[model samples]
Target: MNKYLRRALAPLAAATLGLTLLGGTDAVARPIGWTAAWAASPQRPSEGFTANWAEQGFSRQTLRQVVRVTQAGEQARIRLSNAYGTSPLRITGATIARAGKGAAVEQGSVRHLTFDGRRSTVIPARGHTASDPAQLTVGAEESVTVTLYLAETTGPATFHAQGFTDSYRADGDHRADVSGRAFGEKTQSWYYLAGVDVTGGARSERPGQGGVALFGDSITDGFGSTSGADRRYPDALADRIDRPVVNAGIGGNLVLNDSAWYGERGTARFERDVLDQPGITTAVVLEGLNDIGFYEAQAAGYDRPTYFPAPRVSAAELIAGYRSLIAQAHERGVRVVGATLLPLGGSDHYGAHAARVSDEVNEWIRTSGEFDAVADFDRLLADPADPERIAARYDSGDALHPNDAGYARMAAEVARVL
Candidate 1:
């Protein structure tokens, strides 16, 4: 037997025995329901891979990260990604368990994760793989720690930078460790792992059994929120709604172009990040800030040439992009909730021209009648004294993203609309 399977048998046997003793037969139940409990948008490897990734290419290491599940389930599985890798990625072993404090896992709660009943699997370049379902029961609003052992030499790793939570790493294989002692280093980013799905019925079949995907930029990615606290607007919204709220926001993401540090453009990634999410019946779009800000900087005579080639866009062009997303979502029977662009007048990039453009876009988002519904984010964050600028209490000092209090307001606004 593989090393991973051998190490995992003890915990798996223990869990099974405990379940049997407790009269828990849900693991063997038929017609399993699968819903997304948590999700993160994957982006291409950063240019500063050597500094950011920490581990060297061809070296062996284990990565462990904790994520909060918005919906509970009887069984669970994880998705590993190599979406932007230049070479095949090999996973020697993987495991998931209930999180205990920092990097530790609750004793006896660990489960061995596999792919097609195999302990090890190789994912091809630009591909993603899902683990075979494991009998790991997770509850709503609970934290789960996932550990993966990368045993082969891989190219620049695909990762999400602004996780707003701490992830741990250690040398050699520690995928089955129940304690955080082996984890000697810490980072605030998620690598390889993408989505976590738990088996369950639809919302109509079972209460609190659906999902909402937040398609957005840095604001939605929890850029300024407290790390590891799950204070993002979507996180707050998840607490209010009956469905799981998945964060698909990539920091610095753009709608019209792929000029940001993260993955593909918003329009290009909607299918994989939103449409493909399990049990996602609704998607809230809070993008276009990056797209608008980039050009705004150029228009204000900021001479940073090599940053990004500014694309001249009109309010009409942005509306067309929103329309395409709406059409795609409608085709899949998914409701698209359009969010009005927030105030940006106080930021360095904002000028009279950019303000005019923002006004135009927000105007259409409120009155276009193109989206199934609208979340008036602009009205929620804008200062009444100076309608073009963010309220002083809501600004996160950058004049762009919102503070935690601001995120709470945004979440409350979404809840009202839902």
Candidate 2:
């Protein structure tokens, strides 16, 4: 018996027995409901990674994107991340409006944030942060617009896409305004603005139910997705699914134990990111490439200075680790899905040596059949001519991350299975 399993089961079995003995059945059964999940995409828009550039005429200024709710009467929350920066970001103000366009050209008390009595907050670059709950009285299908203002930036920002669809031009170094008018009416924007918390409310709505978790790496985390596009696959998929889809992807996450890139391995964060989620029913895990690619990229007899080390686990080791993860999820009654990696043949993140590891890991993912369901993202988006390469059509020019269109393809593919 695996040590982790032994430990987990013993306590659970004991608790179950105790409950049975002590009339635990008297406890109310909490209905499982879904929450809105959103994540930035790994693809970059035509303006490049930075949405506010001097030449682009949109820099220094902050932008706003509003997500109006299509379904009303449910509670909602806002989540934010500066997941791709090398430094910290200081936000001057963040606001939620009644589905308005632009910054409102003003700030008001109506702004609901994930903070305690504060209009401004700071987010560490390369890390993620969630806002305090903002309660609102919404109708059956109303909308709420969220606007954010930042002081400084070190790297380009990435965001989930479904809520707001308009673009922006940075005003200067200190400001940017929402561009044009909302794509209102028939726009059918799919990304979320405020996440519906639906955990506690009148049983009348019967909102609580099983939720889907977008469990994976940066792709699920929205690493390369356009800043304002809200086109990341997870966001796209969330818009398509009627149930809640929470984004649990962390940038640079790996499947097997290796070095720490973003605090801990994805497996280590699994309990917190997936199981601990408020109400998650299904989990789609898209990981492993980082372990394979990073491992293969290491120097034959040298060490790199970065905190993250590469390709530590062999193909067999990763397979074993994956099986363990699947078993764990199944034990908890959560369905586990595996996503084959996109090609890395030309990514600056990959080298010839590293490429081999990616290939090996991908092959195992296809044949292992360990996952409850498989999301063959590699085949759907990878270049057909060069099986080991991301299709040019999908490549975001970085050769590793997908473009907006590519992410759409990914979202469509996964939606089909769901």
Candidate 3:
């Protein structure tokens, strides 16, 4: 066939092959408005609030983590991070499935994941990658299991401490294992797992199936909520909202400073953790409590491995961080909702100077009118009589963090504004 004949035959051949050629590339399982259903902010490896596997890393072991999605989807993918790794990270194998009780997975739901069409790929130092989309169906508020097998030693892994939910590990190649018996050792941290995104599903009422991100510190991380109950404010908000809601909170996180055990500061991480969430239309930021509190704790000589030297941040500086997050989100066309710092009078964080700073910052968040919306968590959770302390009923014995009831109240307030 010559030019004329071949040109004429191309249309016929393409029609018969059921293909709509786009620049001669295949269109199989292409992304359809990916929305982040779940996420975890990455942290440097360190001795933390709980036992973490980062230092020991993994060698010929299968690490399994469970996360709950707030968006229903037809297909899904997982994001793996080597954010703080000094050397290239090699992923030998990985899998995803519906989560079951205690390290177990729902049978017949397992799906092997690939990266750039390969079963294995190397993540460059201080880098990350998302697995190719897998044909897995997950429902809103449902849990999914992700298992990774490291055939070789991965030195000092990057991870998220204070996951609140348990993660399990087993020796050998159990990437596809659905049973809990094999995964006996357990930890309370998420290792090298940054986020889980979904696409190729029904678009929600919002364009591109947009999701909302709840970004904050320990309270948003569900530190005081019963372990594994999924009672974080974001979890509760997802129940009330019509669209997807993802938790981007890190326990002990500061708005103006980074921590070895917590995570990158809110301003430094807002774009990647909140705005970058696939189709995130809005973000509710409830940070800065740690910034104010940690300073006092450090000055008072309270020592903990998770506690770093708290920077002496002024109220204006804290407000600057909030302004930065708002501006960045606005640039992305994502709405920003400001939240007041919760009361701290009864906690170790409360000092006269810290109290004055908190009051000033909270007032700005309430009155600045710079944010698209505001959630006055301080006024809402404050004791009516004292006004400086969290109400006894809502306090989780820590006096700083809220209990499950308090989290529910917070969700209601956020929903009312959002």
Candidate 4:
């Protein structure tokens, strides 16, 4: 056996991932149940990897965002977040629909969304709200569009920096517009929209008995995957399985430290992002690369001189972070699946010392048996000849992220453990 793998493979052998994690509606079992079909961990507005509307905020503009849901349902609800807002977020109107090309929506699929029996509501600073359920039949892996009309001068918006799909903008109230023509401007980040939940018989078609929440960083966020392709490993895994898979990945996120560019550390946000998610029976964690890579990249002069507060952490500390997350997940009866950090050789994030720390972490993830299950991605993606760098076929041009094919393999490896 590889030195990293445990002598006893009992945990690794549970490929079917037998677990009895389920939720009851209204604090009791009901015919209709809710499942988080899609999700995005919120991040504080800041200068990010690309141009976005975070700093400028929005005023008298309609924002249309597209997201892919991994579960099926005839009735759905949306969650909006102002987790980082300085003042209350005033929304004049909102709508949800089956997405058409670009900013457009499928005719007749559009549903007006109301919050707490009202068409409009205010989300207090650092708060969020969920819309009343709207009727709209949808299938697994369907793309949904959410349009919000911000009639007031909303201060800096809380958003997900790497949405992986185009978000359209129009100058006025276009909440009910099915023809995307009025929406001219676009960005690749999600503004305010946090999650999409589904319930009803249509969910019977979901791949499995319950949903799996992917809690990780950029790799899980599908950074290098083609925009609008929905080719993230989570998406690919949702395709292969019979259960819903919601992504809680935030690009550039860390396991041990909070970030202005990224979101909160894993331990700090685990409850809201993972535990609080509806019908989350399992959570797969694959983070910590940033905690290990941040300082070395800065010292090597890889740019982002302004990205300070870059605290260096030891491998042991990173392992402890994982332990904290694992304990929390298990307490909620959510099975925890741990993934090895990917090979980082030849990237700006890599140095001799950084490589050692990554190796130490991966070894523990594979052999420690703390996680209910393990997906050995390092062994699966590492270049056989080099053993330290990612295989050329899997490495995106930047040497940091994976291409679509690489994401596919990751999904396959994860499915084996699921």
Please, what is the whole-model Cα lDDT of each candidate in the order they appear? 0.79, 0.53, 0.83, 0.84
RMSD of each: 6.8, 10.1, 7.9, 7.7
lDDT of 4 by residue, 1-418 (tens): 2111111111111211112224666354234456788988888988655679988899999999999988888888888889899999998999999999999999999899988678999988887777877888888889999999999999888998888889999998999999999999998999998888877645544434678889999999998998888998899999988788989898888888888778788898887787777777889999998888887888788777534667778999999999999998887778999999999988878997789999999999999999999999898998999978899999887777888989999999989999
lDDT of 3 by residue, 311-401 (tens): 8889999999998999988877788899999999979898887899999999999898999999999999999999999999999998898
Per-residue lDDT over 1-418 for candidate 1, one digit per residue giving the tens place of the 0 to 100 score? 2223222211111111111122366445334445678998888776542235723433588889999998887778887778878788998999999999899999999998988779899988888877877888788889999999887767678888778888998899998898899998887888888888776423425543356889998899998888789999899898887777899998878888875365688888887888777667788999887777888787777775523787877778888889889988887778889999999987865876677878999899999798888999899999999988899999988888898899999998888876
Query: Of the pair 2 and 4, which is ahead by lDDT?
Result: 4
- State the weakest 10-residue window (summed lDDT) of model 3: 9-18
148-257 per-residue lDDT for model 2 (tens digits): 55554435443332222443323332222233332221221221122434323332234333556777766776656785555666767766766556666655567766
Comparing 2 with 3 on lDDT, the higher-scoring candidate is 3
TM-score of each: 0.89, 0.61, 0.91, 0.91
Candidate that scores best on TM-score: 3
**What pairs collide in candidate 3?**
none
lDDT of 1 at 58: 32
Candidate 4 residue spans exceeding 4 A from truth: 1-32, 201-208
